[model samples]
Target: MAFSADELRVLRRALALALHPAPLPADEVRECLQLAGSVDEAIREAGRLRAFLLADLARYRTALPGSATGYLELLQDALAAGYRPQPDDLASLRSLRHLPLAAALLARCQGIAERSVRARLARSTAGPSGAAVPAAPAPRTRLTALPGGRADIKPARPAVPGKPAPADDPAKDRPVPTPAEAFPPRKRPVPPGERREAS
Candidate 1:
């Protein structure tokens, strides 16, 4: 349905009231829902409808301006108090806080490596003279050339137990026989009446 500019304004007002601490009377909420279509629709479309209201919030606020930012600040305070409004955020905040704790725990465990009571962290991982302990570089995989000039090595895939290969290839990708000598002929057969002696 096409909502007019006037209808949009009324819907915006109704959404704001739904979010308001001292909302409009029950009759007003129901009236807006009827205009909006239904309760399910109003709830489902709350975010969009709320955004529309927020976009034009200044216009409505100017009509009755009373420090609305105060409520937003209250929401921030609620976050600090650990009264999480969303269940999904509980794990996130806990993980965020845990990272610092992990760093501190690592710092505490530094003493276990050093026998000194002072529990000093090593400036260098090597000797007491502050010499550099070279980090062991990762090993490199040398690429050796195959029989062919190409570098890519196509290894045979590991075979499954039940299914076996159909044909035997003495040499992979090398033809069964070269073009010059693919077939060899056999001696011709003779009839019983026509013997070798008669020939």
Candidate 2:
């Protein structure tokens, strides 16, 4: 069924929810499927199929970028060739059949277009007043733990040249073992006292 722009948006949002597996309220579900009605079973089936497709798509993008690209190309071709969707077709389409088969296809395209427009607007506005806007930082993917099972962080700074750093903490600003406080002297047994000498 050819969906209007608004129907496309709702269907896309519902598909995104399903792909992500977020908790769907009863009212939300009712609202989502309201346009489908009881007769258009193809639309509902396509919606379910689209859910699985997008879920796999999300994973494929990260796991196999090249394969994901190939998948999209294949999906486009399949859609062009009358990709009639049969939802819950577990064997053939475990999580992917065609992208444009669902009513949300236009919405998917709109989302991408909207994102691009927003990105361009952000860049254009990034001059004097846009300083208040905070852009998402790029991902920094690296191993959390370093070699030898230690934290992956900067190395401890070496003591500056010529000035030996205190092995103990310098914060205390006092030596632990002062030379004045010496250990007890060895005990020596005195011979017969001077009284014996006077005798």
Candidate 3:
């Protein structure tokens, strides 16, 4: 919010008096109150303006290609005013992506949406105290031999550092057998004697 030179001087004096904890004369007290009122009014006005801009953006978005140009301009203004792009806004932009400005804005809006999702996920994953919780370590993996000597790798849950692993866990006893190992390979009869005689 922009303040006049007179208002700025009053604000400065009020800040100084606040820090120093001094009593102000009747006139200075009145001026400080007036300045505070002005600040509150300015804040309210900004909120109203932002609301109006968003409403306008929604109206334009609903009107689609007919209001494409006006809608794009309003969306740009809304973005500049710190408005988050909605799914409808993304869809609208995607439909209008043939326009150069619309294409650029679509990319920008997609990035904003992705960042918003990531921020939301981060917030959700945060601890009660608002600190970020560390991600769990990746599962451990090991290679196990198959029937034909081919190997396959499978994930195993890492044992807790201080806790003992379960005794009944089959994975702990041995690598889990594959289907090929569960059933033996079939054998085929051979005519080796007759082939050797012909040779």
> What are the root-mean-square deviations of the candidates from the true structure over C-alphas?
25.1, 19.4, 17.3
| Residue pairs with backbone overlap in model 2 | none
Determine which window of 10 residues in candidate 2 has minimal summed lDDT: 84-93
lDDT of 1 by residue, 66-139 (tens): 43344233323443433323322222223333355423423433333233423243443655667645578657
Q: What ranking emerges by TM-score with the best candidate at the front? A: 3, 2, 1
Of the candidates numbered 2 and 3, which has the greater TM-score value?
3
Q: Which segments of model 3 are wrong by more than 4 Å?
A: 137-199
Candidate 1 local Cα displacement, residue 1, angstroms: 4.7
The C-alpha TM-scores of every prediction are: 0.17, 0.22, 0.66
Q: Candidate 3 clashing pairs?
A: none
Where does candidate 2 stray beyond 4 Å? 2-40, 66-69, 74-199
- The alpha-carbon deviation from the true structure for residue 43 of candidate 3, after best TM-score superposition, in angstroms, is 1.1
Error of 3 at 137 (Å): 8.3
Instruction: Report lDDT (CA) for all predictions.
Output: 0.50, 0.57, 0.90
Q: Give model 1's TM-score versus the native structure.
A: 0.17
